[model samples]
Target chain A: MMIKLEQLVPRPLKDRLSARPSDIWNTTLTLEPGNIVKIKAPSGSGKTTLIHIIYKLRQDYDGSVYFDERPLPAIVENELAIVRQTQMAVVFQDLRLFPNLTARENIDLKRILQTPLYDAEKIDEMAERLGVKHILEQQAGICSYGEQQRIAIIRSLIQPFSWLIMDEPFSHLDNNNTRLAASLIAEECKKRGAGLLVTDLDEDSNFDYTHRYQL
Target chain B: MRIQILTTRIDINFERAMRSLNTLLKKLIRTATGRKRFVMAFIGLSVAMLLILSAVQIQVDYNDLLNSKTNQDSIANFLVVNKVLTDRNLGATSLNDSEIADLKRQGFVEAVGLLTPSRFKASIQSASDRFPFFTDIAFESVPNDFIDVVSKDWHWDESSRFVPIIAPNMFLDFYNFQFSFSQNLPQLTQTVVKMIVFKINVYTPNGIMTLNGKVVGFSDRISSLLVPQEFMNWGNSRFANAANAKPSRAILRTKDPGNPTLVSYLKEKGLATDADKTRFSRYRHIVDLVVKIAWVTGLLMFLFAMVIFTLFIQLTIASCKEEIILLVTLGASPGQLRHFLVRQFFPVNVLIVLISMIMITGLQYGAHIWLARQNVYLDTWLGPTTFIAAAAILGLIWAVNRVTIRKYIRLSTN
Candidate 1:
């Protein structure tokens, strides 16, 4: 699977962030499977907005983003749901977990909808490696920011996907925890032959990305 | 053993939570159940009253029509055709066989009936009467379907001891208002008439034979006193002179009495029947007005109940908006949400309908029994019309509730 962006220009709003020089707004880009790419940008460079538009979550833009040669705007709702469920996974910057649910349940909620793509044992194994196994049984709202970030990352990786998109996933983590979460994400991507698109303000030595872009 | 049981229980809990989002939905419904019941009670009571009132209204009007004593012309398509009297005629006009055959051949007439004159002279006397009352009576009959009085006793047998008679309602009015006023006697009601049997003495060629006569019913449409056609034919054959017998009146059943051809043909033949046709028209208009008014009132009540029901649904859905949004974001379809709503609301409405119908039916039966003790017999059960009407209203409530709940779910998701 591939996602292609062509001459995309978002309708600029005053409150939302947009890239400097507006050059990235008029560019064309493509993301292929099994490739790790880093999008390096400043704090207010519309990074999260770009990720949202590509994931078919936002449509306030001028040009097209195509999924397998079909435009995102034209894809039917059921097909988009299937793609989101089994082919594309995302970790938003806000860690959109149900506050009433446990940290383990936040991840298990996505897994339960699919046909047992990842079992409870696999989930426990991932949580153990990411150093969040002790906090798994606690309510997600009461957990620390760094711990919840790791839980959101684990939740995104529990389902099958051709592309795992992360928007500032390790923003709240220290170097050691960031490296641990990055290692787990890379290993899971390699196992499934999926691509990685991670957005961050600066580079860290955890990931040996295949390609890099600046916004 | 305790550790193993604890592990198994955990697994069951996990499985139940993983199946669907019904756990969350159940929690939401439980929280709002009290408020929902309070609102639904008002709607249910309104609907129940609407149904009961409509059913009672229909039954009462039906009974009124059944027992009405007004002279309703055009109740049947048949018109009584009699020869119009003129100054030049000093005697009664007789309709011969050829005239009846000609009337039958007319294009507008569906069928024709001829009146048969009684051959024997008859007189009536009662022990309560100060003087004997005698009359020359004739009997005319159409098909049994044409008779409006619904009674099973409208039959005759030659060997029977008592003669069952149907008399014109006007004859009773004349006796009560005019004759009884002039004389110092008591007036009679239909119930009293039904109870009094007169002694009839018939003057036959052989001798005078005494028979018992009982009035069975009264008809406003036919001006002459009526007897069963079978008794009249047998009596006429046994007593009357065959050569001189003729029918002076003819009854013709027409497809449409207002048709110009039929009217002009009757005019050409100098035949006329009842002239008070406007009274029948007014009676029909009144019946229609009563029915329409009842329907409109019932419909307004139903709409008001529906409004209350819809508000209740909207409130319940609004309270569960957060849970609904969570479910939708988890990839639950709108159709699934609709199925959930239907499952929740359908059984409640069904219970309401069943309970309301039972109460209304009980009320009807109670009224019937009480009235029967006072000598009035009403139908003892709710009719199919009541059931059908209730079903229609319930189905409407279900449909509207489904749509409103589904819309709220979608709006919350968005």
Candidate 2:
């Protein structure tokens, strides 16, 4: 699926965005499938807002977003849930995890939301690769921010999707851990021939981006 | 063949996995927060259901007792009705055409047979001196359907050798107990009485007419001596000095003698019947009152139980509102949540109905055994209407649960 943005601007930052010349805001941009697109934005620039608009989490935006020629706002609730389960995945910047659920359970929920894409062992494998395997049985509430962040990433990857959207997913990770997490994400996306759209504070060598933009 | 086997194995595994997934959903949505309220509501529902179903069963049992062949009396279905004797209507107690027509029009009255009394004077005397008896008597004739006794010789005509007569059983009892003792006569049995021939003397204008008469049967329904309708018509026309008088009494064939409506109708028309036969109406009124009370009380309790159940559901949902919203945000469809909630709540309703049905069945069996010892019979099982009522109640509960679940799930999701 291709993600198309036509003159999209968040309503809260509409005035500030109009005064600036940017590659994404108030512009028509299309991120094609199997392309690693990196969007670098400074703080308070509606970076999370942009990701939410494309994911349909927030509707307070100008212009329209289309997912493969169908308007985003036209989808009903159940159909939208299908899109979320089978067509798109997201890792919120806040690392939204059920505080009471253990890390493994958190990932298992997404895996079983639809049909099983991978066996239950795949959760242990992903947790082990991200070096948070020891915390897999621990409640998400007690885990550190970095541990929760890695858990959230694994949860997003456990489901079937054609597009992966991340909002500063590596914010709480160290250099080596970020590389490990980034490599795992890259491998999964490559296996499915899916696209990745990531927002971050600064540019980095994350899967050799096919297109880089300043949001 | 190998591919087919592999696909079947995969299907089995998928089914197993779905079961586990439901278990996970159950754990996430804990319905145990309001355990005490659920128990109270369950008790209330069960009691209400029992009362309602018992009402249905009681009415069915009462009808069976009244109409069942084993419990029915052969003579109870026919009632001999007459006008109440008052001073103002002393000699005018005959029923007119309009009154008989009105009686025929009543819903409970199946058929009416007017009792035509003999208009001329009559006397009967024993033919043999060994059993000498003489007395003035009156005869009444009624339609054959109203007669409880079956006799082959009950028909008569002008060319016949003798007239057939039916004596009331009360007359024989009176003679055996009182008259025979007072008159120093031997007590006779029914077969002996039936074999005796007697002389009948009808006083006509020209002279006294003599005919032979014999008793053919004994009746427990009508009190007076009965003759065939044809004989009565022939005799009244030939030997009467005055015009035929209107009938003063009628026998009614009815399906339910105990029906309150028929009893009240007779009273309203200033008519009287054998009170012993109509004693069932009083019992029926009492039963009706009891069944109606059960219905009304059961309905009120059922309404309160339903309200409590709905409120309990709302409380459970409201307590877990944030968890539900988060679950929905994580791509849980409204349908999935509603299914899980209904599964959580609806099984208890079905269980309540089933338990109520079993209890009613047990009670019916117990009553059947107890009443059987008293020579009164009822069905050993609950009636079909009770089962239908139970099924209807379960369906109503299911629909309510579905609507409540859908509404609350939508509210939280929005």
Candidate 3:
């Protein structure tokens, strides 16, 4: 109900090699709910730059991003936070799962913040489907790298979002991990109907052909 | 059609920066050394404030009462007694015969005493109504309205036309008392019920005041003798020697003044009740300063404590900055996060206050026994109820004002 920021715009394609936070921001791309789109870019090649711009963190550069189809020339921090709450979900490269918290607690935060939770069974089923049910009771920090990565995706997947962004979520994984992580993330996105944006994985990477696109 | 694979409640992405203060309070409370350190620090501050403020009050009250510039009357300098030491009906009204014998054997007291207020008729004339008149001239004003608290002076309309309760030093009775009710007169007998009154020798309208108030005391006015104790006793003897039945007033003396150390020695013996102590001789000015300092010091200390507490909360949320960023991405509103944090940190200080206040109060209650004296007790004399209320209210207001979780919310959104 609360509209925070409504516009964001990226600078013209100039120099294209500047390292400032604002220089790399891309234009506002409003994906429909559950619209799964991938922004493919090499590591450190500005894939995250696009995510940062859409999320309202790269305020120093060029171009405008819009919220609700309106122009957001620059999104301030507080408004960005509200935007993040209602319309965004992110899968970070480092698997930002709270190490101290258990898988249940990590999931519980999502439900706890919502009015009446989305559904406890959904979390159980998601964990089971991802083969993380065995380690669901364990501390995320102590979990194996693959397990941590899965749990991070699971936590992000459960949120109600208008946009979902992944920052090289599967870059370091072996071929097996890359495929498993992508398939699992794709399935959850299709179920929720939130826009999906992914980066870092190459053509040979295990990603859905329909959603992949180079930045 | 772009197809999202997983579910999400987030609308937008966000990043938050966390920085906290007062981190050590947590670690401090959890361990024995830390807990003891804080408690000791609290008590030390309390004691410092109490002693310094009280010493100043004693110094001030001394100047006012004595008009003496020397003004630094310590508790030991005066023979103070509780105006109501025997009035509370504390069940210790009359000592058992054995107890009396024990006290008598102590040899320090020439006698033990009691008195009741007796009123019939008396006349007084003042050179000028300009001089203030008090209802009970013996005691000063109570500090709080609706709360009978002791202070330097009562600001009442001394407009009433009654024999203002006999002042210990002022006004002139110019009359002598034949004390019949006294058990012992330093110059006479003890264990007597015969009534008498002390005649006041006032130099008013007149020349010099020569009475040192040795014949009068705390019980002197509250006795059945409306007349001055000295006046009544001497007058009674005169009337009896002269064969007269119409003695104008009654007087009773509980102890003999043969030993000047009677009042101080009795008080030390625990004869005074909490409510009974009406005056302190530590320079009225000094006492005033002491009480004021006690109040002001307490107020400021609590204020400082509150700010520190609030900083602790801000620090806690700051520690969780990254988690905050993640939550925002999960579609949790800024209000929701704040609402949760508010719920989280509010009780931290609340717990501290609850536990600390209880312990402080218990300690004060125990310390009050020492505080129950006419002069310079605890640097200030506060009743248990008043003390508790002050501590609670101070803690509450401080807790409420110092919280700044809203700042964390702003930073996170930023």
* Tens digit per residue, CA lDDT, model 1, B250-320: 77776545445666677788777754432344455576677777667666666666677666767677777
Q: Give every collision pair in model 1.
A: none
Report the C-alpha lDDT of model 3 over A1-215, residue by residue, as the tens digit: 11122223334433553443331233333455555566656555556666666665556545455666554555444465555544577777776666777876676555434432256567788778777888988987788887777777777777666667787776556667666667877776676655676766465545443454555
Best first by TM-score, ranked: 2, 1, 3
| Per-candidate total of colliding backbone pairs | 0, 0, 119
The numbered model that scores best in TM-score is 2
What digit string (tens of lDDT, one per residue) describes model 2 on residues A69-147?
A: 8899997578888888888889999877888888998888888877768888999999999999999999999999999
Report per-candidate DockQ: 0.15, 0.48, 0.17
- When summed lDDT is taken over every stretch of 10 residues in candidate 1 chain A, the lowest stretch is A14-23
- Point out where model 2 deviates above 4 Å: A2-31, A60-62, B1-3, B158-161, B203-209
TM-score, B chain alone, candidates in order: 0.51, 0.94, 0.34
RMSD score of candidate 2 (Å): 2.6
lDDT of candidate 3 over B14-85, digit per residue (tens):
111111111212221122323444454445444433443333334343333343323333222222233234
| Docking class for candidate 1 | incorrect
* Candidates ranked, most accurate by lDDT first: 2, 1, 3
lDDT of 1 at A24: 50
Compute fnat per model: 0.09, 0.26, 0.28
TM-score of each: 0.63, 0.92, 0.50
Winner by lDDT between candidate 3 and candidate 2: 2
